[model samples]
Target: MGLDFSVVPEYAHFLWIGVVWTTVLTVSAALLAFFGGILFAMIVLYAPRLLAWPTRFFVWLFMGTPLLLQLYLIYFGLSQVGIDVPALVAGIVGLGLHFAVYNADVIRAGIVAVDPGQNEGARSLGLSRAQSFRYVIIPQAVRSVTPPLGNNLIALLKDSALVSVLGVAELVHASQLAISETYRPFEFYITAAALYYLLNLLLEAGLRAVERKVEATR
Candidate 1:
């Protein structure tokens, strides 16, 4: 069949809905992962061995598995056990939890990249360890950690497509529905790809701006 985009207008609303959900899911998951990662990294770095071991295992569990499977466990598996969750909630939580491990590693590395002498200097100034970590260490780590965090944000954006499996109506799902109705897979799929590319361009631009601002402070 000849390439045809005539059906696009009829399903533009579908794609738009997909765009909205993709943005919402990415932002929510990114926030959860970023902050959750900070907490997890702290536990890994400072907690007693007993606590740290289990936290590490939790991170490993999430990181090692397929995220789509994680979504199934959270959305379908939990419901089977009498804990019902909406698809949107499941999508956000699954993506957040899965990525938080990588963020933990990124953050942990960033924290350690701050010189040991800096920590000792903060302590010699009579700052408590916690105060030093909060005031001196974290600020320095933030500058080093930002680029990797931005890269992960892009991965998170692309992976948001997986949420369609949970029936969350993200970009892929919308494209699938349009393809089913119109039998024009190329047109819809290419449109979806183009939309994702545009979103990535915007995200990359934002990341660049952030990196420039962070660099200005150094």
Candidate 2:
């Protein structure tokens, strides 16, 4: 059958709302994942064996599981256990935890890539281990990891579509709703894909600008 895009203009506003929620979910989850990743990286790198083992296990658990299952557990399973969670909240947490595991590895690799001599120099300056890591190691590590983190941000943005299953009203969810009403899946889904592409393009541009700035400052 020939494609019909006539339904697009009428539902543009609905799609726009979806875009907003998608952006919100991506940003919220990305921030949470980034910080959580840093924490996990620190735990694995510096925490005692007692702490590190459990932290490693936590990372393994999330990394080992499918994000869909994680989302289901958080949103649906929790309710089953008498702890109800709002769809958006559950989505954010699920995305955050899933990405955090990967981010932790990126962060840890960044930290490991730094020269050991840098840490020694910081210590020679009478900086404690924590102080040295905070002031010297983390700054350099962050620089090294920025590109990977930017890529993860893009991935997170794409993954936010998965939250549709939880009915968070994000882009794909909105598209599905429109399809149900109009029975024009092609138009709605194509529009949704275009919106996602545009968003990723904008995000890539922004990340490139930031990367250039980081490079210029170095």
Candidate 3:
């Protein structure tokens, strides 16, 4: 039938629940990713060679793997080892961990983008390397990285849907459930797509604002 509204009057309610869970997952994962990325980038930049290389390797491994596979490993694979991480935790951690690798690389490049002249100038003024980095280099690098960082956060928001496989009840999963129960796939899916578009629109607008603030500081 054409646009079967009566077939699934409850679809809106189910989708609302999905939207809430999706928002929760997206926000939680973004926070973890941001902090983990900063930590990983710092280690890659400043740690001893031995420590740095291994940390770099870890970043590389996570970045190279598919987020879906990582989620499976954390959710199902861990259970095989008796680790039993909660699905919500696994989803957020998996998404955040994956995003952190890419974010770390972006942040590292931002740090490198800072001029050698700035470091040398600070040295000439008798600032130690650590002092120069803290007082001079990092703040500038962080500002430079903000735009790419926001982009990664948007990616994180969309990718959070992958966690649905673990039964995390996010937006996609909710839509799927509604489709099965009501047999109105087109309508439910179109609604889900609209919700995602709205989410992304809000995210992009917010990022643009943050990007402007960061740029203004420079």
Candidate 4:
């Protein structure tokens, strides 16, 4: 039989909604992971021994496990214990937390890449420790941080597909629905692949633009 794409219009809405859910998952989780990572990195770098070990344990726990397993524990394991989390919330939390550990490590490396003397110099100039970090250290760290951070975000975007296993109705799920009904796996799957690729390209472009803008300021 010759290939036909007439069925695409019939499922356009499904694809559109899938795109939206995928975006929501990626954006929400990215923000959570990014900001949460900063705090975690700070704790690792500066927190007293009383608090730092526990934070390290948290990071280690997430870092050592597979993300899919983490999502299962959050979404299904919790429900087994009578604490039901909605699908969207589960995806966001699972992806956010799993990636946060990795981001924290990347951010910590970036922060540490700055010379120790700069930090001591800032303190010597009479700026409070927090102010010195906020003004001088972080800005300098951004130069080192942006590339790896962008890579993490790109990886996160691809990982969003894994959430469909939890029935989040993202692109892969939508493609599955189309395949089931129309028995046109190639068309739908190809479409989904194309969408993912295009999104990755756009994201890379955006990250590059950001990197260039940051460079301009340097």
Query: Candidate 4: which pairs clash?
Result: none
Worst 10 residues of 2 by lDDT: 1-10
Q: Cα lDDT of model 3 overall?
A: 0.89
The 10-residue segment with the lowest total lDDT in model 1: 134-143
Work out how many backbone clashes candidate 1 has: 0
- Each candidate's clash count: 0, 0, 0, 0
For model 2, residues 22-86, the per-residue Cα lDDT tens digits are 99999999999999998999999989999999999999999889999999999999999899999
Q: What pairs collide in candidate 1?
A: none
Across residues 165-217, which tens digit of lDDT does each residue of candidate 4 receive?
Answer: 99999999999998899999888988999999998999999999999998888
RMSD, candidate 3, Å = 2.3
lDDT for model 4: 0.92
Off by over 4 Å in 3: 5-9, 116-136
Please give, for residues 125-206, the per-residue lDDT of candidate 1 as tens digits.
9999999988999888878999999999999999999999989999999999999999999999999999999999999999
lDDT, residue 76, model 1:
97
Ranking of all candidate structures by their TM-score, best first: 2, 1, 4, 3
Q: Each model's C-alpha lDDT?
A: 0.94, 0.95, 0.89, 0.92
List the candidate numbers ranked by lDDT, top first: 2, 1, 4, 3
Best by TM-score: 2
